[model samples]
Structures are given as C-alpha cells and as structure tokens.
Target chain A: MTTTGSLANGEADGTAGSAAPDKRGHRVTISDLARQLQISKASVSYALNGRAGVSDETRQRVLDLAEELGFHPNSAAVALSASRTRTIGIVIARDPTLISTEAFYMRTLVGIEQYLNEVDSSLLLRLTGENGEDLDVLRRWSRQGRVDGFVLFDEHQNDPRIPLLKELGVPCVVVSSNAPDDGVGRLISQPEETVTLLLDHLAELGHRDIAHVSGPFHFIHEQLRVQLLREHAAARGITVRHIEGNYRYDDGADHTRRLLTGPDRPTAVVLGNDLMAVAALRVTAELGIDVPGEVSILAWDDSPLCELAGPGITAVDQQTMERGRAAADLLLRLAGGQQQLHLEAPPGLLRIRTSSGPVI
Target chain B: MTTTGSLANGEADGTAGSAAPDKRGHRVTISDLARQLQISKASVSYALNGRAGVSDETRQRVLDLAEELGFHPNSAAVALSASRTRTIGIVIARDPTLISTEAFYMRTLVGIEQYLNEVDSSLLLRLTGENGEDLDVLRRWSRQGRVDGFVLFDEHQNDPRIPLLKELGVPCVVVSSNAPDDGVGRLISQPEETVTLLLDHLAELGHRDIAHVSGPFHFIHEQLRVQLLREHAAARGITVRHIEGNYRYDDGADHTRRLLTGPDRPTAVVLGNDLMAVAALRVTAELGIDVPGEVSILAWDDSPLCELAGPGITAVDQQTMERGRAAADLLLRLAGGQQQLHLEAPPGLLRIRTSSGPVI
Candidate 1:
C-alpha cells in the first residue's frame, strides 16, 4: 500500500537463499538488478523512486532490469527518508454547525480533494475557530513535521497565520484571489477582471444605468469586485448603485424588491453570485417586471441552479474546476520544492443565458 | 503552540537555567519540569499525554505542577504513541469539478470540520470517484495507516467498500440513514417516514389517491422511502402511483408533464427531495392545476431552497448539522480507542410547510 523507492548499493544475492528457495524467498536488491543490467546503482535507484534525473530510455532499462531480477524495495525504509509525504494540510474556521450553509467552501474542499487523489496525495484538514485556536494547533503540527505541506483557504489580507507559516517553512497555495503575499505561494480567481468584463457586457446592451447586489464587504474578493464595479461604471459613464448581500438568495430578493419599486429604478441589475441572481429573477417576476424588456439581470458564478431556474440565468462561469485543479498542481510543485512565483490563467467564461437582454 | 503535558514524579529542588538554551532556543522540557516539581518521568509523561491511570485530583495537581514549571512535551515524541492522529479521512464520490452540484457533501464536510476543530483534531479528505477509483485509493490509504479513521458518505446496499474497509481494521461511520450492517457503524435518517405522516394527513382531508416522484433506485434511502409509499398506500386502500427521478428539477418537470396532464392525475403528490418538489410546483402552476384544492404536494430533505420556491415546500426535515456532528463524535470516540459498535439515530422531524395542504 506504500509507495516505494529502491535502495542503492545493497544486495544479498538470490544465491544466499537458493538452498531454501521454497520457504525463505530470495531478496532482490537494486545492486543485483544493476549488476544484471551492467548499470550503476544510482541509475537503478533513480528509476525506482520516479526521480527525473534518469533518461526515459535508461529509466525503462532500469525498470525492466529490476523486474527481471524480482526486486521490491522495502516500503518502510523508503518512507523514513523520502523527502515528500504526498500529503497536504488544510485549516478551517470553527463552527462545525456552519457546514450546511457554506456551500461554496464545501465545493472548493471537494475540488481540492479530487485533485490530490489524482496525484496520489492525501489531505489533512484542521478546524480552527475565529479566535485563532486552529492556527495555534496548526503551528504545533507543522513544527513537528507531521505533514509535507498545506493548501490555504479562507485567507484574509495580512492574516496572522501567514507570518507563522512562513517561519515554519511550510509551502502553501492560497484559495483566495486577493490575499496579500508574505512570501507564500497562492492560487485564486480573477475577480477584478471578471467584474469588468461583466459590467462592460451589460453596458453594451443599451443599458444606461445598472444596479449591483454584492457579497459581504469583509471578504477580499468581494471587496475587489465591488471596487472594480465602481471604477468600471465611472469609466463607462454609466450610473451604478450598489447593494450589500450575504451571497444568499433572500438577500438578493429583499434588495431587488427595494430597488425595482423605487423611483428612478435602474433598467438592469448585476448580482454577486447565481444564488442571489435567482432570487432577483423571482422578485422581479413578483413585481411584474418583464425581464430584458423592463429589467435585465446578470449573475456572477454560474452554478447548476442558474440553468434550473425557470427562464435560465445569464451568469459568469468562474471555471471552478480549473481553479481547483490549478491550485492542486501548484501546491504539489511547491511541496516538491518549486519556489514561490505568481501564476495567472485566463479570465473565467461569461455564460449568456436568457436572464439578460438589450434594454428597451 | 504545542499541547503540553506534565511529568510523573514530585518536583526537584534545582536552580533554573539562566544560561543559553539549545539551537531552537527556549528549553521547555519534561526533564526540566520534573526537576522543578521533583516528580518522576513516568508521572510527567502520563499527565502530559492525558492518560487515565492518575487520579483526577492528582492529574489536576500534576497539570498545575507543569504549568507552574512551564513544561512542554516534545511534539514529535508525543505523536509516536498516540492512537488518534487527531485526523479523520473523508471519502466521497464526486470529483472537485462537480463541487458546485454536490451541495450536501460540502455542507456535511464543513460540519465535520467545524466539530473536529473544536476538539483540536484535523480532517483528511479523499474523494472516491463514482466509478470505484476512489474506493481503491481509500483502501490503500486506510491500509497504509495514512488516516486515523474515516467518515463515509452515500451508502448503497452491500457497498463494495464496506468489506474492504472492514478488513482494513479502520473505524468508520456511514452518513446514510439506511446504511446496511456489514460490520461498520451506521447513522440512519428515515426521510420516508415523513411521507406516511403526510399521506395520512392528506387522506384525512378526503384525498383518495396520490402520486410519488422519487430519486434514483440505486440510492438506498430513496428506494426505502418509495417502497414505504407503496406499502402505506396499499394498507390504507388508497390508490398510489410511483415514478423515478434523477434528483433533478427537470426530472420533476418531465414527470409532471407526463402524470399531471394525463387523465389519471392524482389528488396529491410526494417528491423525493425539495429540488424536484419546487419544479413540480412550477409545472403544476403552468398546467393550471389548483394546489391543495385540486392537488397537494409533499417533499423530502428540506433546505433553504424550499423557501425560495414561491410557496415554501413542505418537506421532511433531516437535521443535516446534527447528523454530521453525531457522526463526527462517534468517529472521535473510535479514534480515542473505544470499542466499535453500530449506532442509529431517528430522522425525527416533519416540516409541514405550505407546499402541502388538505385536499379539496
């Protein structure tokens, strides 16, 4: 069950147990294989450990040689000295009761787990409360060399943990797109760019004024997109009104009711996420606002709920899986000793469904 | 940040070191504490590890003794003998790409993580794919001692992993309410029980016939509830019709188009989950069927989505957070060296929201 690496320059030739072959099996070593193949011990060990130094041709030759000699490395001995554990550590905020409501966090975790499983690594998750208890536990665990590395989620700018994690020399890749760097590696979505594209698309559709319903202000990504929305609107000379939401459908509904019925109501609306957008659709329907003809709506982050919503929701597709997979790959490299550097991918997709149309 | 433990013997009357410490600096050790408290090494180690041999009064005294002496056990050394890695491995079916769709999985994971954090333990996650690749990976992980125990989800009757897990000698708690006993622990929730109660309530209102739309047959809970629906109807001598669904809104819409528009439309309907139930409400509305007057509908496994679907869906409430927390607590006990046993808790709630009413 354990990944193995061959030993260098060690051999008790098969002849040692040849006399009692039926009971006491012969021990095949890397040296025995090297000798049989007329190759060096270094080449045999390199091939078995999956190290990159050996050429593909030489690697195959070494592998074939080992198979012919019936060699199997001692898994325990390899484990004791291997540089990597192929395991990642995750720390979460306390309040086990929050698991059901926080759907986004759960999705991200599942994505990370999927990526790790593909690479044959395991995840270690630690829960900490808001008061920094989890951080304390993680600090102790990291110093003891209990795990190879970590994947950081729920990152706040200038997080108290960053300094300590840096001191421990633990490699990490952050899930947050806007978390400030303190020399640690990170992976996050492109919120600022995504918002700009969304605003521009809505403006091009002959809409003069637009309303925005956004997520909680404390989150860095939420704040980044909010700031960008204001800047983009100003540059385009479009009037924009922003409302705060908790990234839930009800918040979207309540805000929609207030805005749609108000004097000088905007012709279109943009929501922070699909859940909120779906709420907007319902509230609009209740108020007798014909979508696109009277008021158009666009949502960020296209989830399956968008398609299932009655008329289908026009939304931003944030490439959640790519975001997750890229994070996993980056974390793996960092754990394998790749130094920290900024890595950026293309912007997420804009999935245009029936929710948004030209302003009449 | 390390969790400190006390020394065994009474304090030693020795002068403190006012000199240079080791390379990491700050020499905090059981040896130093034993000298300060004049205690035996065995006594200090016992108190530090939270072992049971010492009396409660004596344990408190030793703890205070260590605190006063400023003793901290070495983290690496302590980890060697502990039964719990302070880590739980979670196995799931979906890859990270499908994270957004698997909302229940995410919520439950968060709940588990939240509770484990309170106890200062960590969670290790592994996604076994829908096709059994995850099973192979999980088996290898369990065998290699990569995790202390497991939290299993999406139980099917006589699941293939059950036998493999049993042989691995790893303690596990299944999330399914109808989890079969194959020598593992169970956490059961009977969502179908709500159907019987709802049907009886509707029957009392003079409803002579009902229709049921259920999830896939492979799901044990869905199967049990659908079976119970047929049984309950037969016993009451009431006409009932059952249809299969993929747990999707479209499935509900498609089935609604088939049954509701036909001549055999019943006076009432019961859905497998809230997602499909909401769709049924929309479809029935489009077909001009009068709800509660001409037709009454009931749903299962209520969530926030129920409330957003115009008229709130009357659903059987499965306390998601409580169920998750209980499973976590049981896992922690197993990690703490408790003998294994099968456990079940009742699916004890039926939320009678507006989606169901007396038949006219």
Candidate 2:
C-alpha cells in the first residue's frame, strides 16, 4: 500500500496497487486511474489488492511510482473508511415555489450550508410530491451511499417519514418538532412558549378578543402554538378563535377576509407563519381596517417577510438559522460516531417585530 | 468456504447457488455477512473469491448459502462495476434558506429534483457561501468520485466558480449563459427576453416613463435583464430610469419611496422580483398612489408571491420548474455518457394580474 499526497497539478496517474491512499482533500483513486490509463483490469486489481503473486520488482515499482505520481483509490473505498459521502440529503413536503417564499427556510438553509461548507460536505435535496414516491427514490440512493445524512424539512404532526427513515438506518435531523420520535434526534422551536409570549404581548395591549390563524392542522408545531394561544387567552378572560390554513400568505389573506369583515371581529390576530401575517396586513388594508387602532396582527416565524410588511408585522422569531446550525452539529456528531442518538436542542429568540401595536 | 444456506427461516435446501436469486433486493455479499458475524476475514475472503483450496462440498454449500439468505453487495461494489453513479452533485451558491425563499432558485431546484426522481437518480447539493470557498470544496469532492457530474447554480458574471469547475474534469450544467466556457452543458433562463416582453406589454397599455427596480447589479441575469429593459424602452420611445436594489420586498418598499415621492417619477414600474412588486403595492397603499392611473407595477419571476400580493403582480413566468427539470436531464445524460451537453429551454407566459393596466 502506498500512502501519498494528492497531486497539486491535475494529472492522470495510473499504477498497479492493491489500494491507493489519498490525502484528505484531493483523492484520485487507483480504479479511476486504471480507467483513465486503459490498463488491464486484473493487473490493476492484483497491484492494488496487494496479492503476493505479483513480482516484487513490479509491486515495489508500482507502489513507489504511484506515490511519486499521485494515484489514489476511488471515492467508494474512501467512503468505506470515512462515513462522509460529502453530500447531504434534504426532504421537503411542499412545492419548490412555497419553499422559496418562506424566508425562514431560506435563511436557515443558508446557515446549514455555512456549516456544511466548513466541513466540505454537499447538500442533496428531494421534494416529495403527493403519495411520496420520491421517498422510495431517497431510500434507494441512501442505500447506495449517495449521501451522508439527511436534513428533514417541514415535518407534519404524525409524519409517515419517521418510521421509514428509522428503518433505513440513515442519520437525520428534523426542522420542526411535530413528529419528534424519542429514538431520533430533534431541534425544536419553543412553539408553546413563543405563542404564550405573543399572547402576553397582545394581552398587555388590552385586546379582549384575539383570534389565531394557524398553519395546516396536520403540522404539530402549528397545533401546539394555536392550542397554547387559546388556553392562555382564556386564562386572561379573553376569547380566542382559530382558523386553519396552510402556512401561506394567500391563506392568511383568505382567512383575514373572512374574519375581519364579519360581525364579532377580534381586536387582534395571530398568524402561524410570517407569510400569512403579511397577507393579513394586506387584507386589513383592503378592508380599510385600521391596524392597531381597530385591529392588530402578530405573526409566527419571524422571517424577513415580516420586517418588509407595511406595518412591519409583530412576529415570533424562532431564530431558524441558529436552529438549523444546531441540527447540523447534532447530525455531524452522530455521523462521526461521537454522540449518542437522540438529542434535543432548545428554541432560540422570540424577537417581536412592529406589526402588533397597542390594541385600542 | 462453506456456502450452506443460512436463511433466516432455516429451510437450508440446496437452492443456494441458483442464478435466479431472491427478488426482494440485491443478494448480500459474503464479505458483509462475514464482517457482521465477526468470523475470520481470510476464511470469508477464501469463500467469496472462489479459491480452489477449499473442499468441494464446503464450496458448493458456501455458494448455496448467501444467495438463499438474500444479502446484497453494498452500492460501492456496484458503482465500481457499472462505472455509473446515477447521482449528480449540485453546487448551490446559497444554503437551504435560499432554496425556500428565492422563488427562482427554489423552483429550479424542485424541478431538478422532479426529473432526477423520475430517472431514479438523486441530487447531491454542496452549499458554498458567497465567498470563494465553495469552489475548492466542489473540486475536491468531484475528484473523490462523490458525484457523477455537477449542476452549477447562481452563475455570476465573471464567475470564478466556472473556471474552477472546468478544471475538475467533470461535465457540468450551468444556470447561466455568460459562463466562462460556453461549450459546457448550460441551462439558462431567458431573463433578458422576458424583460423585453414585459416592456412590450407595458407599452401596449399606453404606459410611458417606466421605472425599474432591479436585483443586485453584478448578477449576470439581473444585469442582462436591466440592460434589455433600458434598451427596449429607448427603442419604444418610452422614458426609463432605474434604481438598483436587491430582489427583496423591503427593497421594493425603499425604492418605491424614492421613486414615487421624488420628482420626474415614471407612471409605470417594473420590479426585478415578485417580492419587490408586492412591496411596491404596499408602498402605493401607504402613499395613496393609484394603480394603473397614477402608478402601475410589474414584477418578474411569476410565483405564489405574485398571486398572493393583494393586486396580483403581473410577472414574466420563467417556467422555473421546467428549467430545473431540464438541468437535471442534461446532467444525467452527460453522466450516462450520452454527451448531449448544451441546452436552453423556452420561456413561458407572463401572467397578467391586477397590478398591470393602462396608464390614464
């Protein structure tokens, strides 16, 4: 076996050796070189596998020569010794267009990429359409060692992905806590506490009627936040009503149009996501409802969209970037075999933006 | 060298060496089972390599064994044998957050995933910060055989990534036409043409003195589109001026304040992104600017952001998903040795929403 540094100059080097050892960064394996050189397969195999039948002179010359010329084993053998495949698999539940609109997901993904860059790992993505035939595709690629681990996005309340992911034996981390399995590691935003704090902020504004517009009911984090808002509002002798919608701006607009223009209108509204909140701001404007004078809106998931909204939506900042980084760190630890399975990182900041003013 | 059928069910019939093996998945290699069992490595090697030193009965038994048990070789062996990875590496300029928020990028990625899934190949993403570090990471990973080929995202004018990627000796599909090397597989969206079409739509509506709020100045697509808009307006005898800003909603608001309140303001405006168009709507609402009468706005990158924008933004639908799928197909073909490298897909409709109308 010849252990050598990768060639500084990009050059094809072919030598017969049982295996080629490469420098960590620039590996060009013997098999790759063999293919490049068009050498006999058996000769290259004998040379690399270190079978004793090969002449000593030829073997020594091959090893020494490969070292001098920078021949290394291919990525497959390298993968066996090192767990990293230099790729990360990500699973998203919604359309690509939806993911692009959510600033939180965008920024958090940026954070994950920052860490991945530090380690020289790549990110692989899969967006599952309805019925999740895509999941099966993921399963096959993962089994074939196409990626190192997975970054699971937009978890549902009772995710069907969990059991299958577990059975497959790939390392993964979830963005939301809706379907947090005890066996799997998680990075959860403090959804309940975030909602409580938002309620307190609204309650302090002297709002008597507060209504919540939450994301899809299937999403556990939305359920938890909405439930908390209801319970907390009741404790303060305030009545709260919740309407279900996807975590989308249009949904927010639709819900707001229904809620704001009707009798028994709430003085304040809370949204499950920032997109929805921005929509609510637009709806309120269209209906000529004075914000904070007649009604106030508080949004969840403090993405940049909240900051850009006209009234500057008052939002619950989950610090998605911090959460994404933590998830990456935990997954790295697991991949390295340095940590026990199943870790839980805490929620981050609850930055309140400007949308919700003192309710008149 | 015993090949006795060690089926989990313990049937142990002599059908172990049958060429027609169990169809559940791949047959597990003897080496994997031997490693699992912690038996002597030499013994397992002897049985698997088909060396003639062992007894005939034991050899047949060993041959009969693992097949009935249904254990398959790891993907590494298959990859080496077939010389095909069935996986493509994508080097993303930004991280996951960008994937979720930037409609163009997210839609493209999703489209890429859609095609790859159909072919049973997977995408491998390597995220690099805006800094130049991503090139080195991609180069190293490509050399190591981590991916069959690559898809380059966010190609900038005078982009350094192009040169570095070229040196890696793998086929690549770029989301840009201004690539350093035009011969490589390219997937470029016709943004410049889209801009001209937007202008035609506006000019036909009797709008003059149009203003533009563009994305970052250096991005090749943004730069080209801006230039196209300026040229098209001059050709059409319509007055034009532009303010540079990011493709962000807040940037829209900021530029709107500058353009609307300032002297010599254009009656119509075109935004580089849908988010900015949405922001412009909010700004108009705040300043009491009437749409289509006093001021009108158009946006680029038709997405849900446009539809959700109160007065839906009139935008050039870039067929982002189709772009992504085309890129995926190109990379797969190159990796599969078909070698049809360069491609430019057609642009789709410019969906007219509530925002765009004739100037009074």
Candidate 3:
C-alpha cells in the first residue's frame, strides 16, 4: 500500500501526498537496486527492465523495490530498454516574439500541455530559424532516447522535416494549415471556408471593389487563403485587388497606405490578421476615411483585440484553442503507437461587427 | 586530419561537412565499438568514458577510434556521470495566448537562445500556469540531469523558485525589473529611471494631472513602476491617479471606459504595456476623443504596434532584446561555473511621438 501510494506520488508530482525526490539528485541506479534487494546489479537491472536474466517473481520484487524507493525511472535510462521518456518535443519554427503575437500557437501549446500533463508527460520546446536547422536536434533526441516522440508545426509543402521524421522512424504528429495526408499523422484547419464566408459576408453588404492585404506567399495558410479569395471573387464577379504584407503591424499600415493611394481605391479591405486589421484602422484614421461608411474592414483572426479595437472589425473566428487540442490528441494517439490518420478543425465562423457594413 | 574532421562533424552537428545522424536512430554503443575495434565491450566503455579500468594507451586508441567512426557520445549517457546535458530551462509563467501579445518574453527568449546556441547548448522551454505548478518538471530535470542551468524571468521578490534552485544546487540566473541584489545571479533592468523620465517629459509639456494604468500589484515590476510614478508625481506636485489591470486588451478598454466615465479623468494616461495603451486609443476613439488634443497618452514598452496605433503612442522603449540577451549572458556565465554577474540593461528611453503634446 505504501509502495502504490509512493508510486502514485512519483507519477503525479507537484501535488500534496506526492513523494518528494531525493534532494541530493540521487538516482536509483542498478547497483543501488541490487544493494537494496540483496541481488546482483545485472540481475536487478535485467529483472526490473523486463530483460531475459531473472524470473517473473524476481522482476516483481525488483519493481516493488523500485516503487518503494519512489524512483520514477529516468526516461533516458528506460530508453535503452525500449521505455517511454513520457515527454513530447515541439519545434517552434520562428522567433518567440513573432510566434507569441499569434495566439493560435500559444493556445495550441496550452492545449498540448494540458493533455500531456494528464498523461504525466512534459513538453520539450525547441526554436528554429524557420529553416528546419533544428532537425538534427530532433534526430539526436530520437537516437539518444531523449524524447519519446515529437509534435511538429508550420511545415511547407515538400517539407524537409517530413522525410526526416519518417527516416528517424519516430512516432510523430504534424500540425498543418492545409489538408496534408502526409502518411504521418497530422491535424489540419480549413482556410478555404474562412475565405468563402468572408466573400459572402462582404458581397451581402453590396461590396464589389474589394482589396485583400495578405501575408507572404510562401506560408501555406496564406497561399490557401489568397487562392480561395481569388476564386470566390472571380465567381461572384467582384473586382478584387491584393496587396502583400510580412504579417506585421507596420506592414498592414504600409500596404493599406499603398492600396488607398492607388488609382482605384477599393470600397472594402480584408487584412491578413488582427495586427494588420488594427493597423488598417490607424491608416483609415490618418487618412480621414470613415470605417464602414467609406471602406469596410475584415480581419483574419478574431481575438479580444479585435473587439477591443474601435468599432470592432468583422473577422473569422479560427477556433485556435480547439485546433490546438485536436493536434495534441493526434500526437497522444500517435505516441501510443496508434494510427490516427488525419483531423480537421471545424470551419471558422464569420464574426460580423461594426467595422463592416453596406458600402455607401 | 580526416579523423579530426569527422570527429568535429559529430561534435558540430547541423553545420557544413557534418556527417548526418543515422536515419534509423543508431546510437554507437560500447558493444558496437568493441565489435568494430576487436576489443571487449567493458574495455571500450572504460577507455572512452575515462572510467578506471583502462590503460592510457587504450584510452587514446579508444578516443581515436571513436573520432574515426564519427561517434557522438549521447548527452543522456554522459549526464549519468555528472555531466551537463548542454540544455538550459526557461519556464514561462502566464497564459501562452496572453503571453504572446507582449513582445517582452519573446525578446528575452531570443536573447537566451542566441547565447545558448553560441555555447553549443540548446534551450528547453516549458509553460507554467503562473502558479509555479511546473516546478515539478524543473525538479525532475535537475535530478535526471536534463539541463545544466536556467534563465528565470518575472521573478517576484523572494521568489519560491530561488530557494528551489538553491536546493537543487543548479546554476541559474534570475532576471528582474528592479535591482534584485538577491545573490542568485540576477540581471536587473532600470524601471525607476524610466518612470522618472516619463514624469519629467509629461511635466515639461505642462501636464499636471496624469493617470497610470498599472498592471496587477503582485508583479514586482508593476509595483516598482507604480511606486516610482507616485514618488515622481508627488515630488513634482502633480495629481496622479492609479488604476490596475491584468495587462490585457480588454483590461485596457474596460479600465479606460471606467476612467472616462469617472468624474475626474486625468488629462493624460500611462498604460502598463503596449497592448493596454493601444486599447486605450480604441476606447478614446469610441468616446469621440482626439488624442494629444483632448487627452495625451503614453504606453510602457514600445513595440511596432505603438507606432502603428492611431496618432502613435509616446512610449518608453524597454530595449527588450538587449535586456533579454543580458539575462541569457548572465545564465551562461553562471552555467560555466563563473562568478561573473551583476548585469543591468541601459535605462529605458521615453520616445516622444504624436500621442503626447501640450495639454489642452
């Protein structure tokens, strides 16, 4: 009973009634186990680790001894014996500052952490220069048995990490923006539906000439949105022009200024994200243009910031939290060696607000 | 030369001329080495790892063989022998979503990552619920020898993590806004001087009554900023009011709406951070107020969003990137068992922009 209680404490660490680890960084080495159980070091190691050395009764006794000592086996030590580290790796493919602005990544991370916590698995976060240079670290982790598996995000078409993940032969889940049936497990979100909803909403308001300021063309999600917008705009016979931005606040303001100064200024504008949408409002104010009355605006992502902005912008709710949870679930299943093929988050909702109205 | 070159590749993985890690996760084990070099596994292990059983000639031969084979000693294996994992831990204490909007944390992470990369170490990032619940992971990593040191941020006075670090006997650096002087390898930023400069700037512009929308009282930086604001306001014989916020956009909007509805609204307002300040502009616009004419506004922590906001907010540039780098440098020095410390970033500069002007 004390052994079970202590083992539970070791598993559910950081709570009351949990067995505190030895303050001296003392590990339950094979020798330590052998000394305690009055057995040979090799015998204890093989028995506890389920190797071919000792009897079933000896293995049970060794395991019981381990539990009594409150030793939660080191994942790395267990790796050599084909055991779980109870950890997941996530590589953020950008600078922390840029990544932080998109609540989607953070919310998704929270979801992953929540599910991993339930399984008593911790997360190992790594940063990359958007160039997949950290792929080697992931490889080393696999070889050295550092992490049991990984969850990847922000992959481009023909991603280098995809082949690497397969080559490493590790259980992994890739979070994607588009439908990537990449053989490996993945979670995808619908970008086309968001664009369609925006076009419909903007069309209902009698907007013919519209401008969409989008992020860089390389990002899969950005490209998908742009493609969808062009298709819908052509089908509906709406005159649509596009401007490109680097997904920054300044980019939004600069591109909007360029859009307005053009020979034919559009009656409505759709910016890439919340930061750009907010920047668009600043541009409209500087140019003495009345929002909705002169030019309506729709943001890509709806956050509290959108609502907090003056005359809250009409935007699509990406349901980032749910998307994040789905990705985590996919990884959890994959890490368990189960094949969960693909998942898609529900289509984004069009949040109509004060920023969009009938074009005058 | 070829042997040395191959060894360097194993050591400097991801760089040019480095041999790729085995796709199938092949760790060159002692057995593998013994079989290849025609020696006993025990002799190979002892000679390669500097354990007592092997002669000096055998050790050199083992080392040469290892280099020739491009063998990289696993970090986890080395860790068991009281070696570093070459990883540093950083625990973020906030909602990942809310934390993303503030550029401060990310800038600091970049700083930490940059330094860690230079030392051929990697970063291990973890998310916390702001309650230090993630301390278990930190403790486990220490006992398991997963990381060599830590870079801590948002530390409260007498932070619980400080005592925990001392108990773990791990090298760490605590980054604080105020002069910590906590003897825990702290890097301080100039909060008081920034507050003073702000007051002086506003006072010079003939602003008598000013309001500071401070963050929650629990945060040490917020407390220091509020104290210094009160001190300077009192010294200058100016009427100053303080409002509290959780430092979110909604908090900015809700608090500003409250400030405006109140009978005594200050002529100018200072927000805890850039987001709150940006939200204040939206609230002002909703109330049909003209910035720098009816009300002057100042935001703490300048990001590009500050410049992109309507009329632009006069903000204190926190030099966040440099601040972050300093914190990282401090942690690195500590990790190397060096006593070099007592780092402080240059004082924040109050960048005067369109948002602040002569009081109407």
Q: What lDDT does the true structure give each of the candidates?
A: 0.64, 0.63, 0.68
Regarding DockQ, does 2 or 3 come out ahead?
A: 2
Evaluated against the true structure, the overall lDDT of model 2 is: 0.63
B74-193: candidate 2 lDDT, tens digit per residue: 222222224355667777655344354666776676677655543345667666544454665577667777777788866676777667766777777886554344557776555557
Q: Write the per-residue lDDT of candidate 3 for residues B1-360, one digit (tens) a residue.
A: 001111222134321221223444453444455667776554665665567767888888877866766654433223323435667777666766676566666565655554343233567766655545567667767887778777877766667877887899987777665665556776666677878889898888889998889888777887878888888788887888888888898899898888876888788989988889998888888898889898888898787667656577899988675566556555654665555445565568889999998887
lDDT of 2 by residue, A1-360 (tens): 111121111122221122334455434444344444454333343455454545666566555655665654332222222555656677665755566567766666666665555434556766555435546655765787766677776677557676677788877777667434456656555566665677678778888887888887777777677677777778887888878888777888999888888899888888888788888988888889888688888887776566655567787777666566556655654555433444344454456666677766
How far does residue B43 in candidate 3 sit from its true spot (Å)? 32
lDDT (tens digit, per residue) of candidate 1 on B1-360: 211111100011121111123345444554454445565433455666676555676667767865555443323224323654667778777534444563556556665665554344567777645545667666767876767778787667767767778888887877665745566766655546666786677677777788888877777777777777777877777887878877777788888778888897788777777767878888888888877667777776676566555566777766565566557756665555554444454454777777677766
RMSD after CA superposition, every candidate: 14.0, 16.4, 13.9
Native-to-model Cα distance after best TM-score fit, residue A342 in candidate 2, in Å: 5.8
Per-candidate TM-score against the hidden true structure: 0.72, 0.69, 0.72
Residue B58, model 1: lDDT of 60
Compute DockQ for each candidate against the true complex.
Answer: 0.29, 0.24, 0.17
DockQ of 2: 0.24
Q: The CA-based lDDT of model 3 is what?
A: 0.68
Q: Rank the candidates by lDDT, best first.
A: 3, 1, 2
